[model samples]
Target: MEALNQPLQVELGPLRERMGIGDLLRYERLAGIPLRRRFFVALTGVLLLAIAMLVALVWLDRTGILAQAPVLGIFAVGYAVLAAVGFVWYAIDLTRRARLALFAWVNGWAYADSLEGTRRPGSAFARTLRSRERGVVASDDERLPFELGRNFSIGTRDWGATVQRPFAFVELPLPVKVPHIVLKNRRRSIIPTLGLGRGGARMELEGEFAKHFLLLVPEGYQQDALYIFTPDLMARVIDLGAGAEIELVEDRLYVYLPGGTRFDRPATMEATLRLAEEFQRRFAARTELYRDDQAGDLAARAGVAIGLRGQRLAGSGVSLMAVAATAGVLLLSAGVTAFSLFGGDLLRAWGAG
Candidate 1:
């Protein structure tokens, strides 16, 4: 029993050590501090402004110089503006830093590489496997191995909120052939596209066909290929009468055709349309409505606007109240000075009469 336990213990020790190392590396790589730092910095700015305002109010009260209403009013407005600017600046800085932090985390080892950069494999089947490996390649229950190459294209359009900028459009193009594709409306705002490569042959488009055609190329494929396309605006691509040839290996998908084939068949067109619809649905369900970076930007902008507006309003209200107080103090001071200089003489004359 003792001998058997010793072997088990030895095996467990190495495994534990490897796990610890991996855990440590992960923490180091993904740990973030930007958000916390920004919060503290913004807080500090507010505190400092508050302190300065308190000191100024106290000094003016004690010196009996609060009688100057006009001068005090100007100072109050200046302070309000200054505080508003500071708050806005802090919010923008915080948002920018937060975005950087998010980018680091998403692109870290925890997430797989972007599909856009994956290379296709030399053999048809191998290309598929490479694509799977490059993306978060998986199905419902099991992790899918790299298989045939696939292409993904994403696009977006923004309807302007204000009148100045009415609309925005963006487009992204993909080079590899994709089978199973996903399309998502990152903002739940626009639709995206996914395209498959024409077989192993490359073709150029001409005339009216050229306007709707997109060039699909096979390059830099190793093992298997997966293509990911993210677009910024509305764009569509037609198959251009080309069909993609793919081979499956080791439960992976690969593109066998060196170049995509041209397909002018009715069947191919129907298949392509079906494939596109499937991808669109898959992506719509899976894609997140808002990305971390975009969320941060929106939050930051809102926070800054709110903070600045609130600060300005508060400061203005306080200054106005102070002005009224100062005005009362000045009137009291003048009355007291006049009484001291003339009251006794006036009382003596009234008594004699």
Candidate 2:
């Protein structure tokens, strides 16, 4: 915790310095094989495009067409320029990722440019498919472990559209498994689409907390949630979490920020670290000794266990408003089609008569 208070060493000056071929290779290795392959693929495409452009220019010059149509030459040059620009942009992004990884290493944190196939216990992790995390910074401290990252979940919506939505999350693993509880940020309108839908019992807290968050827990776990989310804890969560959505599932607490926060920014990283530290400290204390009394026999056993029903929220994957909107759109489309077909025919008949 003392290390977190010290000035964060996030200067970009060293990263901005010109990198040698050896430096590039080192960074590529640090970035991992997946990202390295991506860089090579992009480089190959750029090289091939440049070669093709050169060949075309040579052919045009030999045919004397360059003299006849200067505009054609200009267009070819433009295409090559655009391809070069794209290549440069991709290269810069790769370098930025490498720098971020290095920074994490220097600060004793684990870094991953791509979190494809990596598994973590969370409610959002369970439902989402084709999960991918980028620019993840994980604390190496076993005492205060947490991960701050941006992830996008790929899944088909009810309308059969394949959608990929991005979100920023802070994942903190707890000591004991607790009943699933989701504290949905009411201010951010996007959480419903990305979150575990809406069927679980909506828990409205007393006072101003209700306006800030709509707490959701499994049918019988309302009291359990209340037990964990004491007034002081709720106040701390509201103050630190801001508009971020919170969910306690399995043995982890996930705080998700809407619209995906950037991990590249220094200020953002510091703030995220602070939030994670405080959240882990406060929430973990509340839940560390929590043994779901509803677990009965399991509670009677040596280890802690949540009740079967309390283990997961019985919520629909789609929100009520989303369902209503889809239905409305379908009905409106049907009405329009019916009017266009039958009403047009009736108008024509009347006109003829």
Candidate 3:
């Protein structure tokens, strides 16, 4: 709490020197962070040089070096453009990561350039073909162990578009595993892209709370969700997290914000901290003693366990609206085609131009 009161401190002078490609690679290797294709970049540079040399040799060996001048020039120009783009991309990525890493260092928080295969329990963490978390800031404080990062994932066919979707998230660890509960903010279009699909039962809260949030909980676990999301907590969520989507699965609570939430800004980071703290404090007590009676003897053995059904939302990740939209597109196209063919035939039969 004291740290949050203090201004966000970042020392970039020393970090600037280490932003070089070699230094960044060393840092990544030592930190056990994913390389993000650093080695591939180096390999590509060498391969490009080799290809250029080969092209030069072959062209020089031919009798009409002058005749091939245009072709060689084109190759060289393309090669230069490609190399320049790669270099620029590499520099930007490394600089972004280094600054975030420095921010973590000054504040005594853990940082990762890239994180994958987390296998965290949440609708957000469901099966993904390509998934990664970058620029991650994590706190080891047992009082409110949490992680803030930008996550990108490409879901499967049932999961919607294979296009990678990016979102910023703050995840807090819960004391016990609980049923899946999701709060979809009614205000954001990105919330629907979470691919929560039509899973679970849509729960409507009393009063104006229903206007801001659409709650989803496992079919029979409505009581559990209501218990956790009491009136007071719901109010806090509406006030602090009206723009973010909230999901609780197993033993983790994830607050998903828009992808553009910039951790690089002090205000943004502070706001995220406050949001995480509030949610953690409120949720911890409500979930600490929670045990699934449906777990039977397993609850006794594991101390805290959720039943298989409640462990995950039964609905597939595909949303009904997405299905409806796709169907509508197909129907529209079919209708257009039918009208074009039949309308033209009708005109011909009536001898109308």
Quantify all predictions' global Cα lDDT against the true fold. 0.32, 0.74, 0.74
Among all windows of ten consecutive residues in candidate 3, which has the lowest summed lDDT?
7-16
Q: Could you tell me which residue pairs clash in candidate 2?
A: none
TM-score of each: 0.23, 0.75, 0.70
Provide the lDDT at 175 for model 3. 84
Clash totals for all candidate models: 53, 0, 0
Cα deviation at 47, candidate 3, in Å, is 15
Q: For model 1, what is the error of residue 342's alpha carbon versus the real structure, in angstroms, after optimal superposition?
A: 54
Off by over 4 Å in 3: 1-93, 157-164, 189-199, 297-304, 319-352
* lDDT of each residue in 1-353, candidate 1, tens digit only: 44423311111111112223334334324443344344455667776776777677667767877666547745865785687688777554334323323332332312222234344322211112222221121212111112212233221122111111111111111122222221212222111112223232223334443343333333222111122222211122223212222221111222221122111123432343344333333333323231223224665666431112111101000112334565789999999999899989989999998
Candidate 3's displacement at residue 61, Å, is 25
- Give per-residue CA lDDT, model 3, range 22-111, as digits (tens): 766666675665554665565577578768766775666575773656676567657766776777777676666766777777667798
For each of the candidates, the C-alpha root-mean-square deviation to the true structure, in angstroms, is 26.2, 5.4, 6.3
- Residue-level lDDT tens digits of model 2 in 45-163: 88898899889999999999999998988998899899989888877766666666766777778888788865776655555556788778787575667787777776544423223
Model 3 lDDT vs. the true structure? 0.74
Cα miss at 283, model 1 (Å)? Answer: 17
RMSD of 3: 6.3
